[model samples]
Target: MSSGQQEHEDYPVRDEQNEAELQESEAGDEMKPVKIPPRPKRRPRKRKFVAGLLAAVLPGAGHLYLGLLRKGITFIFLLLLDIMALLYFSSIGMQINVPLLILLALLIPVMYFYNVFDALQAADRILRFPEEHDPEDGEDIKSAASARRRVRITEPGISFGVMLLAGGVLLFLFRQKPPWLQAFIENSAGAAAAVLLIGLGVLMGIREVAKNMMARAGKERRSRRIGRYTASATLAAVGTLLFLDWSYGTDDMMLLLKWWPVIPVLWGIEYLLIYLFSRRSKPGGTVRRARMDLRGLISAIVLAACVFIVTEQEHYLHLWNRVSLNLTAAAVDYGEAEGHQFEKPPLVVPVELNTSKVSIDAINGDILIHRAAVEDIEIKATVWVDQLDGVLAEAIADQSFVEVSEGTTIKITPQSKAYGESGKRQPRINLDISLPEDRRFDLNVRTMNGGITLQNVEAIADISLETGNGELILHRIFGNVKGKTLNGAVRARNVLGDVELGTSGGDMSAWEVSGAMKLSTAVGNIKAYDSGDAVDVSTKNGNVEVAGARAKLHAESLNGRIHVRSADFGGDWEVYSAVGDIELFLPLTGNYTVEGSSGYGDITTDLPGLVIDKKLISGQIGTGEFKLRVDGNSNLNVSKY
Candidate 1:
């Protein structure tokens, strides 16, 4: 059987066993896990202290530290751009100053993003390769050492302190002036100094406090806190300025210095105190969380204050002045001194009527007629000397007048002048009359520049009073009243008759009126309160406010708002405005034919009896019962509760 044959068979078996061993080795290699080295833990790098100091001085220096050359240059360019924009706006007569300010406002976000990104990248770079610390001095080492030793005394606190000192010095200098000068200084400089000191203190306080708080907070919360604080401080400053300006009539600069500087200084002090506390506390016991909740609360309070101020301003501007009755009339003639013989010297004819009716028409002075029970007419006539060279009062006292009529027709003329020992001209003669109370006759009175007031008068027919620049006041009157004024306000209170009041450019207010009230104004608002029966008010350019109106109300405005509240209407209610919104409030059971429409707005109605016309959605409201029309392109909704 041969040794060669056995060896060959053993060799094949040996090869087969070798192949199995190779496959087993390959399977074990697939199942085994490979050893991998752990990635080095990333540590944020500490930026060079010099870089931070430089950034504090000039906004983008930190980017330069991270070798972001283009960004650093861009920062400088933006700063220059802002300066140039400010100068350009100043040169443009300040009309475009708002646009420049808005541009600056937009730039703030850009600068913030740039600062954050640069700081993050700089930190990353520092962590990646920590600058080698050398015990032996080198150029970089010396530079870093010098930067660390550099003291920063130009911070906001230091600047504000310097300003405060300067202001105090100026105030002291101004206070050393003479009495008149001292008064002027007190009015201007002393007030200004006080405001400046307070403002500086507040600003420094807030800035220091925020800075300290941000340092204690982590990166994620620091920026948010700073932003919230800045916004809150700014709003507070603006509000304080406005309030001071309105109440005291101070200039904007004085107001700002009075209030704004105090916030920063106070905040800064608070921050310093907090930092001191943190430094004194045990290392692990110091709280590390950011004060985000506190900041949010402050922001909310600021917003609420702003809302309150806005609402208060709205109400104050809407309130109209109340009307009162104090009547005075005077008429003087200069024609007598010119030797012009007068057909009728300014006469005071007191006539009494018995029918609750009185009327007057004077060309230059006021004519006042109060209702009383008079049986006949009374006249008081006084004539003045027609003197050319004497004083007006002397001529009037030197002259006397003879009564022309006894019953109603009273006509008197001015007499010649009397010469004095000093050769001075004097007046001739005039008459004076006192009438009975129970007069109902038609009395005529006229005036040009004096106001007329009718109080507690009962007239069956009518009373007319017209003035050029004086106010007309009617109180507790019973009868139809007609009043006209050129440049003064007309006020009617507790009038139990039909009222027709007209003003050319002043405000008109009617309160506690009984009969139909018609008020018209050219430039001021018309307000009617507690009006009885139907009331009709119209204005050309001012707002109309009506409250507690019982009867139907018809109000029209050309350029302002119409606000009606708690009004009940028996007949139709109509309101029209050309350029403002109309707000109407009624009771749940208030019923009438309601019609409302707007030209370019929606009609909102809470009235149940409203019949809305779809096609004229911009023109009218309600159906056949009541109609209200408004013209604008705003929102109008009618809701029923």
Candidate 2:
């Protein structure tokens, strides 16, 4: 330890002596002084007011000015696409205007903020990092001088070539004399050209992408090999599928293979074959590999064939046994005579309609008979059915007659031949009647599976229509109507009469109604718009929407919503819902009487005159001529401007 310490101490002393000697030598040598270079002056950056303005008008314009051309172009393209989509959707009446406006509103501010930020940053960078221009070499100077000359000469030649080629192609295809040959050659050439162009473009794009990926990967042989193999396999599979589909008409094969039962059977057979082949093969042998390859090829071929057969069969079947019918005239006859007392017999004793007078009923398969201008008639007819021929024969047969002593009485009896051996029957009759203008008729029509349409028909007294499973459409009717349907919609348009519609399971819609409207449905919505009188709509499980109504509304839904908008209530408005929202829009000036209650909901109102009594509101607005009441057991809200 002592010897090591002595050596360490002696090393410091030797270093001090060497330093002294070096300093003495330097002093003797007489060193020269160093000179410092001056710093370069920084230039002021130009203002980017134009760039910022452009960017404000179009997103990414400032970036384009800053030489971020790729990013700038991408942003501009996306912005343009978004704008076009917004405009297209708006023009198509998609009702996405509010959401689009909000998005655009937000985007504008964001774009402006980004543009200003980027412009300032770009200007700052330009000011901080100015580029130095270098002197041009002889070759560079020559190249620059020749570039413009070359472009000037090449531009005209390129333009002429493109125009000549395009014109020649168009003329060859369109100006050919022979029609069939021209069409064939033009279609073939066009298809070939399109395929070639698309193929070349795809090949070039894929090659460029592959080159970039390979360059980035450097010498990573494993990664490059895997990438190449994966791309090659995918391309091969796609090309194979396309070739088979085109050359062998494999579309039908694919369809057949897609059948529900066929797919499972094929899959099971394939797996079973694979299992058996694997069991028979030796481990790590070429035989197993060969078997696998053969199985895959066979499976693909079989599946393709199956699909083709199914597709072709389905296509053929779809083109069979389709019937089309156009109606020329349709009329309905109710047993009524012209100008006859309700209790008087008809003047014409034997009322008969010839076969030529009636048009054959082919559309809905319904027999129609119309009495032109007869009154006070009695029709007692025996309707017989030929069981052997399945034909209905209706005749008086000397036993049946209809005696109309009073108003027109029309009676419908089921023919005996219409029944099967088991006594089951089917009613296939559709009747549409056009009553005489300014005349009234009481129609009692019944059908099992047919519809009755009455348009421009008015009953001065009362109109009643009943259907088992068909729709009843009443349009422009001016009197009271009572329409009932078992399973079809009841649509009344421009009806001036008091309407009462009932449906077991169909929608009820009334538009432009002048009188009080009442509708009930078991499982469909009730929609009324532009109604002048009070409206009441009830449904077991359907929504109710009333718009532009100037009368009191009482709507109830057992399991749906009630929506009312722009309503002027004469008295009160009530809406009941079991599991849906009640959205009501009322005028700010009208007084409202609201009685709302919910078992598990809130009752809210924005009206100043609305007085809340627990879940009910009974109040007056302005002159307070009418009282309003709305009662329910759900969330209720009232709002006024």
Candidate 3:
């Protein structure tokens, strides 16, 4: 009975199940025949050209226009940082940091082009993968956007932090200048560069370490790049060596710069070590070595080229010295502080000889000759030695003396041959001499590294003065004066005879000369006032000014103006300039003939009777006796005094 009843019930259930299975199969077949439409294409962004133009004009403008707020702000911030750095370097007025300033200057164009290209690429990326469109691939687009956002935010923040750190370091250096830090700040570009590279390497190594830590924490499938670590370590090592040399005042860094071939050898060794250590066993039973990608190769090439250029340059190859520092108007504080100064007692010498001529020679000291009422010659010598003790200085000073020679010349020498034999520890000797003012004597003075001053002295003969690198001054000298210097100024006042002065790199001036004057300089101005005789002045690169000249006057300049004021038309006057103007002032009642011509310029006359015509000026105020000739490459102006 159960079999018969179950058969009927099972038959209906089996029929219903069969029908349900057939319906499901039919639904599956229908769905299989229908295919999903391809993801919709994102329309290209409008005004793409305008966005690029804006980016070209301003680094971050295009990114802002493309709705990338963070990226745009980052670009702008970097641009501003670059500008501020440039301004800071330029405004510092320190010529020593020129290389650093140039390096920062080059970042301007690099950042500009990168920002433009990045903006364009960002627009293209949006066109290819719109955030809101393509619902089927929404997850992929979101992940891609998230990755880009992370990179944009992380890199800029890291850059900003690095800049802040550098600024803080510089501020600290400027505020607290320690003894060792002075070497770094004393016009040594190499030290600063080393610090920069070391800081950058440290930052890079820290970034890589942080990335590895984060990857491990997130269980991300990422392999570390060995090239980055190698580069960072190399930079840090090189920078450390440079810093050591600079801080310790050693010549090791300079030697390294000269022997630049060692750099390539070291680089090869680094690569060999990297190859040996970077090998890793893979899952396929094979070993793999690290390989530099395109980015690394480019970076290495750029860095090598920069280093080679800097090291090979003649100017940057050597460290700055005291002479060079002084040339640039920088004080020789470091070098000067290395010496010990010592003063000795005065040495009195009686002039028992009937000689009226006195001569003094110094190796490295200033000489001052003063007029005194004493009958004997008084001498005071000051010495400076390289050693800390005063013994060397006193020894050097003891050997110096004054004596009456057999040739009737009173000889005063500050240092003897023993001082020269002292080698690098040789001392500097400065002398002060007092001579009798009632008697007229011939003065002869020469110095190597010191100034000469002779004031209120009655010289019976020509007063000769010469210096290798110091100034020469003559005041109230009643004789012919001759002065010459290699790198210092020449000034004379109240000279009673002919005056002759010449310098290679300093000004020459004479006031109230009672005789003819001749002044010349290669790189400084020439001025003569109240000359009683003919005044001749010439310069290669400076101005010439002559006032109250009653005799023949001649002034010439290679690249400066010539201005002459005549008290009377008593002699012929000639004024010329190679690349500047000529201005002549004459008395109104003089009988003079004026002849003036200017090349590529006009000649003007403010006198009542003189006129300028066709770049030439020629006229006469009365019966022509004296002659005035002015010629130059620039303008020429003649006027009445």
Among the numbered candidates, top lDDT falls to 3
Write model 3 residue lDDT over 299-355, tens digit each, in one string.
644663464344333233112212222342231111122365566677777675577
Model 2 misplacement above 4 A: 1-416, 604-620
As a whole number from 0 to 100, the lDDT of residue 411 in candidate 3 is 77
State the lDDT of candidate 2 residue by residue for 1-641, as single tens digits.
69989998877655788989999999877775666888865544445776677677777786666554544554565455445444543433111223334354455565557666776565555444333211121123235435444332222235445544654554453333345543443235323433443453356347635753564444211111112222223233333443455456454234333443543454456556545653453333323221233333343444334333322332322111010000111222112112111121222333233201111111121222233344422222222223323122232112222222221333333222223354343223223223333345544444444455666655545565555456878777766777666678889888777887887788999998888888888889999888888888889889999887677777889998888887476755667788887777677786554445656667777777766666455566677655555545567666762
lDDT agreement with native, every candidate: 0.53, 0.51, 0.70
TM-score for every candidate vs. truth? 0.37, 0.37, 0.46
**Segments of candidate 1 deviating more than 4 angstroms:** 1-359, 366-368, 371-392, 396-444, 598-625, 628-641
Clashes of each: 94, 35, 0
